[model samples]
Target: MWNTLVSIFPYAIAYTIPMLMTSLGGLYSERSGVTNLGLEGLMLVGYFASAITIKMTEATLGINALPVGLLVGVAAGAIFSLLHAFASINLRADQVISGTAINMLAAALTVYLARTISGSGNVRIMMGIIRKNVPFLSKIPIIGPLFFSQSYWTTWVCLIIWALSWILLYKTSFGLRLRACGEHPSAVASAGINVHKMRYFGVTMSGALAGLGGSVILITYSGEFNGTVAGLGFLSIAALIFGQWKPLGILGATFFFGIATTIANVSQVIPSLQVIPPVFFKIFPYVATLLALVLFSKNSAAPKAIGEPF
Candidate 1:
């Protein structure tokens, strides 16, 4: 039991980070009154942009390209999200429809662009990937194996982002305004706040974070662009709801989902679990997600103006 627990912990962290970041993005957007459901599409653009960048700059940037690729993804996600913001916030289009268009366009566009640029429809890079341990931290007996040994700096970055998000959303004036914009945009605008601009900021940051989320998955685990986020973006939305739209709550929800997700993939690595049908493990996590939503979503509270345009 102890060894199984230790072995599975790191993989859980790998899966959790992306969901954590993307859920945080959704929290920001929804809190600011724009229902930005294009998280899935935004993440795809991020993955494709980062992957293609890494492929092109392998020699020049080397393994350091991971961080650069993430930045590129952030930009790509933000730029693509900007279109949704314009349609929803400026044009006053139905926010869900705008988001769906983004999802549709981003998915098709990335595949076309990736195929055009790579010719073989795959973009991969050898960026001198290496994993290192934290010096003194890894010396700890039980804690080290569960944390420092198998993880990358990306895990720590996600933890820091989660912490910062909590502080930014709950303890800052900007957060107050963002929350206000979602619950009562009229009150915010009447108070002399620029509601439209706030919504734009929220939506843009959401895109950036979701892009970074997708990039983390690529750099930390896959090391290639396979042209899809594999529904992680939608799962992040579920995580946002499961967490009840709070940072700490989202953390807990993503952790559970991440662990559930790993069970199917990691069964081959554990001898005791080898007898279980692969199909059962494959379906388990998704079923769990559905059960979680069905059981918990009705009790969930959302901002009053979440999908409302200013």
Candidate 2:
């Protein structure tokens, strides 16, 4: 049982990183009074951007592709998110509607670009790779393999981002102002803070993180880009809800979902668990998401001024 568990731990970590990034992104947007329903679309854009950049760079420069891919992915996510910010924050359109539009646009644009770039709707990556493994610490005992061993930059970066988010949200005045803008924009505005600017920053940050999530999917886990990134954006939203919109909470939620996801994919390989059908396990995350939504929807307290234009 220990060996089996250890063998699958790395995969779980890999899956958790992207989910963590997305959930954190959701936290930023929703916490700041914007319902970023377009997370899925944003991620799709990031995925395509990262993949295409890597492929193009590899073909043209023959240099290390991972760095190029990472830069492109972050830039794409930030750029696309700016659109959401402009529509919802600057234009003062309905946040939900703006998010929806962004999502749709991202999906459409990603598919079209992917087709144009690869001559198909899918792109594969080769050569440059983001490997998994910790420096020095990976040499530790059993826990090391489960946590530190064979881990990608995505995993470490997610952890760092999670920590930064927690500090920013709970410990800093900037975070307080951001939260105030979400909960009581009028009050924040009265205090001489720019509510619209805060909202724009929050929404843009969310997009960048979501884009990072997409890049992680392409560079670390799948090493390819396809439509497979579609449902993950929704899953990340669920994770945000499950985490109750807290950064640390999101990490826990992501890990739980990651474990469920890994179990579903690897159940067939475990001889001891051959009796369980993979189909049932595969549906676990979605099922859990539904349950979480149903249970938390009534009690979840979003920012009071959320979704309201300042």
Top candidate by lDDT: 1
Q: lDDT for every model?
A: 0.85, 0.82
Find the 10 residues in a row with the least total lDDT in model 1.
Answer: 125-134
Q: Each candidate's TM vs. the true structure?
A: 0.93, 0.93
Give per-residue CA lDDT, model 2, range 1-310, as digits (tens).
Answer: 9998888898888888887888888888888888888888888878889888888788776656777787788789978998888888878888788888988888778878888877888899885444657787878897777898777766776798889899998899999999888788888899999988888888888888888889889888788888558588888888887777888778888898888888888888898867988877667777886787788787765677777776
Q: Over 4 Å off in model 2, which ranges?
A: 59-63, 128-132, 293-298
lDDT of 1: 0.85
- Backbone clash count, each prediction separately: 0, 2
Runs with alpha carbons beyond 4 Å of true place in candidate 1: 274-299
Estimate, for each residue in 167-220, the C-alpha lDDT of model 1 and write its tens digit: 988999999998999999999999999999999999998999999898888888
Q: For model 2, state the Cα shift of residue 177 in Å.
A: 0.6
Which pairs, if any, clash in model 1? none
